[model samples]
Target: MADQITGGCKCGKVRYAGTPLDAAPFRCHCRDCQQLTGSGHTEMMPLAREGFAISETCRIYEMQGGSGQSTYSGFCPDCGAQLIRRSARMGDRVYVHAGSLDDPAQYAPERSIYSDAAQPWDAGSIIKAD
Candidate 1:
């Protein structure tokens, strides 16, 4: 396992490092994710609150999630690159945008959620059960 995983925003204004890369990622196909990513889905990897470190301040946006808990999104203020997400529904779990990783090829979504909200044209066989 990698000692730590590192990445940054498109503009390199916001950088982050998550230690002990032990978490599996998942794909979110919800409408909000699609809108945020401008794609069919977004890949997310969860890290402990302390496991992640940031280099600079990021702009945050919050909204009430489906679970009635506030979800916070952190992004680069300069280039508007989305970086992380944290939700009240998922206590202590700070989710990082997999796409922000320096090498996203090292990770893949273990499963997909909110498939019902997936766009009809968004079809793929990426998920594998284990």
Candidate 2:
């Protein structure tokens, strides 16, 4: 992982910086992730919530997650760029959308979640879960 992870919204209205958590990055193929990203999956990098900080307030959308807990999606109000994902099940960490990273190339997803929900077109891209 990078020394310090940094990213922002598409409009640069909501920037974020944090220390990367020790968790493995993952690709999620859940329906909610598909809809939120408008793609087959969402690549996420976990960050320790203790030091995570966002430059501006983000518009958050809350919904029930697969774990039967509240999950929040944070986005840029101006550009509607999805930047963060947080779930009550994992309060100590926040997931940052890999696409939102300033250096997206640094993102390396090690596993896939909800792979059973993966669409046919994207099924081949699923990385085996560790």
Candidate 3:
């Protein structure tokens, strides 16, 4: 784990790793994220898609965004926890949820993307996404 990132599903299935959370992390307030997480925002860390390594089998689901971007969200089929997500807009970055990690400090979000859709009840200070 010192050389790379490591985390897994709640049920201990669907593990993954990548470059250390050296890559800047951010929070996403996009509607897609709020809807996907059923929360105010998504604490995601963007990393190289190729750098991501999977251990257990995961469920890959595809969805087309209103922006005409295609995305494949990968998660644990058993626990139904999202581990990583990929899209056309982000060629190499795999926006991962910070909560998924054992120690989420490395993925601390520096900003939030798409604040226009953010819930009024959410009072986070991170920069909202455009």
lDDT of 1 by residue, 1-130 (tens): 4567788899898999886345678888888888877889888977777767887578889988888889988899899888888898876678889889887875677898887788878857346456
After TM-score superposition, what is the CA distance of residue 130 in candidate 3 from its true location, in Å?
Answer: 15
Predicted candidate 2 versus true structure: per-residue lDDT over 55-89, tens digit per residue? 75788899999989999999999999999999999
Question: What local distance difference test score does each model get?
Answer: 0.80, 0.93, 0.75
Highest TM-score scorer: 2
* Number of backbone-clashing residue pairs for each candidate, in the order shown: 0, 0, 4
Model 3: per-residue Cα lDDT over 1-130, one tens digit each: 2466777789988888877545668777777777777888778877667767886488888899657999878889898888877888767777777888867776666676677777888855557444
Give the per-residue Cα lDDT of candidate 2 at 103: 95
State TM-scores per candidate.
Answer: 0.89, 0.95, 0.86
TM-score of 2: 0.95
Best by lDDT: 2
**Quality of model 1 by C-alpha lDDT:** 0.80
TM-score of 1: 0.89
lDDT of 2: 0.93
